[model samples]
Target: MPANLPAEAKAKWLRVMEARTPQEKLEALKDFLSSVPKHKGTAKLRAQIRHKIAVLRREIEERKRKRGKRGPKFFIRKSGMAQAVLVGLTNSGKSTLLKYLTNANPSIAERPFETKLPIPGMLQYGDLSIQLVEAPALIEGASKGAMWGLQVLTLAKNADVIILVIDLSYDPLYQLKVIVSELSDAGILLSPKKFEVRVERRRGCGITILGLDPMECKKLGNLLNDLGISDVIVKVSGEASAEDVVNAILGYQHKPALVLATKYDVSRDNFNKLEGACRELRLKAYPFSPQIPRENLKRELCRAIMKALNLILVYVKTPGSTPIPVTLNEGSIVLDLIEKVLGNRILGEVKYVKVWSNRFKFNPQKLGLKSPLGDGDLVEIAI
Candidate 1:
């Protein structure tokens, strides 16, 4: 041991020693690599750490290939307006966040992998409730069924949102790499600058394209033909390239994701490192801490989730009462809200609605069923 090592380096080494899971240890090892002082005296120690990290990575990959079949224990039923899953390496404060955000009381411990199964919790934000499920720790090679990762990913595919719970107390950037790589391999993409391709198959009609050039459309059609698909209507949106077209044709969907940097108060330097890394990777990281008041954390999380999911809250009133809030997608119309709140019965009698949209430069206007609703719109139904 180096006698003149920095205090932060010593603390990271202690975290590595206290780590109880492979993924946690991997994160600690990375922290140690960054914290250690660079000098001739520590060259041998740095080399050893690098070698161990490489060896552990290989071992984790091997275990992934050797894992057996998974059964029904990993199922999660999503409730509320949207569902979000927390994915990260072990001991990333996922369980702690879960306890704070939802009604779930998962067994919290100082050890890694304390959560072996999927734990579901409900996070209520205003009139909207989101289902937040904490998945088992995801390690490298998780897409290949490493640590039953495929099972957890299966649940993620069904979720409307994916919230990555990163531990800023350690090497959150590296842990994020592991999580993103695994999710990508499983055909789950998380990008705020994401593109969407809509393919509508039409009988006996040649491929028609919208929002893309003719050449791009022809290329996409060829790709789809190779997959035995033909006669389709394809619409590309949001800066989609050739590669994005192919991915969509192959049943790929762009999923919205948010990053939550846990234990932000533990170390400012570590938090900064995480934020910079996420920015380079085109991800936005939100700060989270159990040490802070629970309400504050929840409000921040709700805002992030709403942004990721492209959702807005709509307040609807019967006539003489406080507006009842209902959550809906950003482009939702008045008819959609009526269907969600008042059901089909209201559709028969309601002709128009009076709305005050603070989002747009408009006064209280009477809108038809097809009129779009904005965030925080106060709506009144006229029978």
Candidate 2:
């Protein structure tokens, strides 16, 4: 659009406009960016061209990646109420914790790296079963592809909650910092906070958005224009940052995580330091030891992880049978429970539902489909 644009640059821009495939558009964009003159007046345009090239390149790369084979060897199927992965440095009693927490029988050893691969175990807590996995130890420079670090973290990232196990006998704070740093380097966010930005690229349609104010849209438009991303649907939920926009475009997973301090009986001084560090990092830490009653510790650990995951335990009761526990996301409603308990076919057959809660003295109370269900609520459905 600039009058001072060179003829060659304009010609390449025309080719980009005419290009159909992402690869072709990418090539034309690169050529245009290369041919364009670098001046203060054209700085903004140049940036836009570079951004477009990057976006196109990413699309092409993603397509190629999707063409590759997917396998079960690297990925574990999710099961149970929630999947929690145990991560820690070597000899942090991860295997011991696994054996105690769940039925897993991973070999416990004084040596490091005893558990070479991921071993999954099911932990039962208050009629709720959670799938817990013991992943390989994480060390420094893992993001650089050191010692199967990426593979281990990849599995951890897919989990519903990352149970970070740190040995209180050592420098627990520094170890926690290392794990957090490496995870950050791998583009895995451990915050419970969710980004308020969403992006969906559509072909032939220009940018359409919701949840973002006018100024936010204007700024986002400029960035998308730079990336040559014209056709997309972007929704922003909360106050998002520029980095969040780029991450949304790139597609990264933000997982909720909590700290599990092992060997509480090791050193009170170190345990105190670890607690202080966890507070500073805004992370919740739960201490556990083999000295405590096994059942109590298991229940405590499960309860802590459940709270961190923000889930609710719902009990479904039938007229002639015992109550069954059902896990649902926090803030779930009666309709959601119906869908979970009974299939869609059965959902239509339901006439009404009765709910009971602690507030209601566990007495049967009629609730509409839209009624919100709380943790430990009981529901009885009649068709």
Candidate 3:
């Protein structure tokens, strides 16, 4: 069941949604939490709201500390093909891995939590560049305002891929468990997703519902109405539970992740155990250590991230230019590539596309916009 918030709490939520800045949101969220009734039904909702408040407060205070003093950025912007964030317990070789992959040299100290802010480095694989970011180290309670835990989790939530760097010298499974639990509590899901919902507030799209019966939609609509959510499109999909729906309303994300077992040369037995556990848990794990060659590790890590993200590369040729690489989801068709290569306005103007791939023997195969593109395909568009 939903929170079934009272009118006062609902009004407070509206103000929270309307809030523009961190300080404004912090104040509004605090006020909203006060109005929420204390009960078993509202416990999870209150916890999520409190987490949001803590994150906002931290952001505000961080900005204040950085006021006019140019500091290393806390918020990292995305670049290159995709963003792959590195997260692990302190001193798990995240900084060393970043240093090996990219030119950005972060301090690689023996002490834990040496990397206070998010560090970014670029990994070049063939012709593609994937952005690799090392997040601040995580502690047990990082999700609930433990020394920049929420910030690190937020980074993971926004990233296209998550790299769980674990040390084989320690209990790899235990470290992995703590990191996954913290991420799960912060609404950043790494395991297989069982629920998905999208709620959008759009004008003229009045009370639209999908994937639910009329009565269920009506009940859900009434719940949203109580919270002043009108003219909204609520899309529900997958095997969702009541709690899943509530978490969706609270804004949760699913991420694709893999594990990199560091210091693997130290203990093969530990690595073997971790690998077996990863197989059972449906996660991919790789071995890493100082003994292993760094260059080969860089290439292997880059390709792994691409595959984990399920991304593909396609080449587009212009009239007077050479074919250039473009990235898209693995199963995207030619039209999807066209819309990206040429803007949506050009969709109607395309006459056809000529594609060349290893599957075809001829010089070029004539394909329509709907034609499926394979990896490393060269395409010429006619308009």
Name the best candidate (by TM-score): 3
TM-score of model 2 relative to the true fold? 0.75
Off by over 4 Å in 1: 1-72, 192-238, 343-348, 357-365
Pairs with steric clashes in candidate 1: none
After TM-score superposition, the amount by which residue 153's alpha carbon in candidate 2 deviates from its true location, in angstroms, is 1.4
Please give, for residues 1-383, the per-residue lDDT of candidate 1 as tens digits.
Answer: 33346657755765675577778888888997898778776776678677667645654664464365354467687688788999888898889899988999998888878999999999975676889999988888776656676667767777888888888878777888888877876667787536777767565676677887767766765654433344567788878766688666533557888889888888657877888888886778888886788888788888778888888998998678789888888899999999999898769898668998876577788888998998889999877
lDDT of 3 by residue, 1-383 (tens): 56667767866776776777778888998999999889877787788777787766765765577575686666789999989999999989999888877878999999888999999999887878989999999889987768777678778888889999998889998998998889887778775566578777666665687877666777777666544455667788876554455556755677888898887777767988888988876788999887778778877887777787778888998655799999888889988998898889988888778998997889689897777888789899877
TM-score of 1: 0.71
- lDDT by residue for model 2 over 101-167, one digit each (tens)? 8998999998888888888999987687889899889889776667767677778878998988999
Task: List TM-scores for all candidates, in order.
Answer: 0.71, 0.75, 0.77
CA shift of 380, model 2, Å:
0.8
In model 1, how large is the Cα lDDT of residue 124?
A: 78
